[model samples]
Target: MNKKRIPLPWTNVYGLARTLVALGTAGTLAASSAETLFRPVATIGDYPSCNSTTAASLFCLSPDDYSHLTWLKWLCVAALLVIASGWRPRITALPHAYINYSVFSGIAIADGGDQIALILSTLFVLPALGDRRRWHWEQPQEQTPETRATRLLALIGISGLITLRLQMVVVYLQAAVAKLPHAEWQDGTAMWYWGSNLDFGPAPWLDTVVGPVITSALGVALMTWLPLVIEGSLVVSPLLPQWLRWWAMGAGLLFHLSIALMMGLWSFALAMAGGIMVLCLPLGSTIRLRADEDVATVDTSPSQEAEPPDPDRSAPSVEQPQPSR
Candidate 1:
């Protein structure tokens, strides 16, 4: 009797999501200077908290001097680069979580993206810890027998992913539902106000292109209500079929991209894009594993081959001579 094969719950299904999260946080830090990210004044306040004896961040582990801080920031970037490259996930997972936590807790100015990255990176550590592959993108070999311990670890990792998915659903649901009470969102004037803002508004060049449309009443209604519709759909995306989930993912990404373009929230867009992939993508179903494909080929080969003819079964037997009988 063949032993049942136990599927490892942790696999390359979330590889892209991990990479995107790492890149988003890394890009934000790499693009900014130490001075901009860790203001001298803010550092004074946050340093003690971040550098506490128990929960010290890499940033807070050292002196808050500009040169040292700069070096630390770059080191964090290097670690994130490793994570983004999908290498040695078991080694890099905790470091990735630590880096995001440092950025969120130690930075002078942070956004929603930073918080999301922190949450996701931490959650990803569970899956990464359970995965035995050197690279996060690697699939397990076919017919690999999982030990009880490994199976438990994989289940724990999968639980973390499920929690992450539920968190994403709540995030979008709250965003859409919370906006319902706002007068501007209700009246459809929110987009116009946001578009016309000086600090976070679209660049002058972009404004020139979208100005006419945003200024129109119809455009305002669409812009304001469209996000609510998209966000609501994303909230229920887990229950949606694969195709609809994909559509929701596309719409969510587009929505975030528009914010990035208009409000210069590139990090936010990247972080949310990763979340969308986690929320919408069906686990273990996105990429076909080479081992599985090989198995499939092997399974079909026998059917394709013409069976050898059974001489006695396929051919009529000659009648035996009956004269002696």
Candidate 2:
């Protein structure tokens, strides 16, 4: 009997799926970290947590609500690592990738606003697609190139981490800038307002420690001017002195962590964790490519060289030039 062939629509349907996954990874990692860190995690005796007034439904995420978020965050990171190792990520990743990206479709679809979940989906899309130019209609069983896997993995290393840092900078900067318009933020009153908020149980004393007068002024300062300074520095991180940039990075984490503790924005904490990617950025390629990182190569062949090339072919090939004849 002759085998009947099946047709594949690589574009529109399948292509879109891939794009969504890339964006989802970035957005999920970034947003989840922020959401998890800034907002409290699921707990007893509370309505669901929502991060934005724009999506109040989002605010009501349960312990289960955040399940997909954290799961996707780590899963993407893991997929990136495995892909970089060229361990045939397609075999294991497609399943996890689908789950990592797709679960939130309903939530995003249900609650509209240019698809926030889509943001994460878009971020992760490039890493997952392997080689868009190389894509061809084929069965899932078709062998995936190790080069494609490796390159994609490398992209995850670069883009995933970089995107997270950018997101962190954006988050803090946006918060800081938004504070600028608010009279309270300018005078540091917003900080006090946050400190004074009683609903953030088990921590009423934390925000209120400062007398109301100081609270009011600090609130304005934090809500207003601080964002300008943070965002300004964020713009300059690339050009700023390495030491200062590093300190800014540290201050960012500490400041956010403090917010998490006092304001109880647990998702924000998680977002900060995602931003942990920034710390890794300073390390030279030696460390990041895992050359300095001692671990078993994906290919454990004893004869194969463990050291990657100076320009590792195994690393993600952003745009491969045709080899010179």
Q: Best by lDDT, which number?
A: 1
What lDDT tens digits, residue by residue, belong to model 2 across residues 1-325?
A: 3322211111122222333333434444445452343343345222232334423332233354456545544655566344323333334335434433343331331221123333433443434444242331121221224365544454453464356456545655665666678776555555555545666422646535544433455444555355466556665575554446545655665655665676555443433433432432231111111232555331111111123222322222112222211
Error of 1 at 305 (Å): 30
What's the lDDT for residue 163 in model 2? 68
Q: Residue 145 CA error for candidate 2 (Å)?
A: 13
- Angstrom error at residue 48, model 1: 7.4
TM-score for every candidate vs. truth? 0.82, 0.44
lDDT of 1 by residue, 1-325 (tens): 4333323444555777888899899999899998888774532564324645425667777675878988998998998889999898888889888888888888878889999999988898877777777887765543445578766776677678789999899899899989999999999989998888899889998998778878999998899999999999999988775557757888999999999999988888888888787787544323442355346321100001012212222111112111111
Model 2 collision count: 65
How well does model 2 score by local distance difference test?
Answer: 0.40
Residue 64 error for model 1, in Å?
Answer: 2.7
Clashing pairs in 1: none
Q: Alpha-carbon error at 99 in model 2, in Å?
A: 4.7
Error of 2 at 16 (Å): 28
